[model samples]
Target: MAQITVVQITCGQCGHKFVLNTSTWPSTIQCPYCQEEMSQDMIPRVKEAWGTASDLNMDFARYHADRNETKFSVDLIAEQVHFPHE
Candidate 1:
């Protein structure tokens, strides 16, 4: 099993907040609720707002915290080209 860490993210355009697994953190992403694109540069401002636990932040916290699903998925496949038999 892989250790998963949850990170809170915010949409820079519409101020929507959501939680994502750290493994899936990217430079930019779209807000699930408003479909607004967000950049990594806005993380600091979002963090500050979240720290205060404002009304909107509270709403986000209640709805998006530790949700067991992810908005995106990645698949990796590896094949062995050759195998040696003794």
Candidate 2:
């Protein structure tokens, strides 16, 4: 049997978690708990209190992206995180 996993997601606007069954992990989803949508902003430094795949700080990536000498693979942050209205 294939092991199923629960992806803990929280809504940035309402701070709601959605743990449900699906075909696969979605890039994004609306929170059924609060009828709010979630995104990377709602995602904490830690994905689920344990830890996230992303670094605690994206300074390194930002620094690289800012540098003109090296070609940055990642896009530099341009906008601030603005949660959806509840």
Candidate 3:
């Protein structure tokens, strides 16, 4: 099974941080806070965010798995695709 992760995006317009899904990559994305359309230039930002999310997820899973005596499921419970939060 594939591990699900979150991508944090800083809106160019509103400058607010929001969570994005990895599957929504390489597409037209908008900032929920300001409705700013993410241009091609923002691809790099998304990529960086995805990398950070991946690293965090991996670290969290590893930490739990190490401490748990039983099998640890790292599978994430997915929420809405585009959720804007602090």
Best candidate, lDDT: 3
lDDT (Cα, tens digit) per residue for candidate 3, span 1-86: 65666665666578787776676565777888888887788678768756766777777777767875443433333344755772
Please list the residue runs of candidate 1 whose C-alpha ends up more than 4 Å from where it truly belongs after superposition: 1-5, 10-16, 40-86
The TM-score-based order of candidates, best leading, equals 3, 1, 2
Better of 1 and 3 by lDDT: 3
lDDT of 1 at 39: 59
Off by over 4 Å in 2: 24-28, 39-86
* Per-residue alpha-carbon lDDT of candidate 1 for residues 40-65, written as tens digits (9 for 90 to 100): 77766654443444444444444554
Give the range of the ten consecutive residues with the poorest summed lDDT in model 1.
69-78
In candidate 1, position 68 carries an lDDT of 36
lDDT accuracy of residue 37 in candidate 1: 72
* TM-score-better candidate, 2 vs 3: 3
Which tens-of-lDDT digit does each residue in 1-86 have in candidate 2? 32223445555677655563443434555787666655566444324432222232244455555763342232222245778983
List clash counts for every candidate, in order: 0, 0, 0
Model 2 residue 57 distance off true place after TM-score fit, in angstroms? 25
Score residue 4 of candidate 2 by CA lDDT: 29
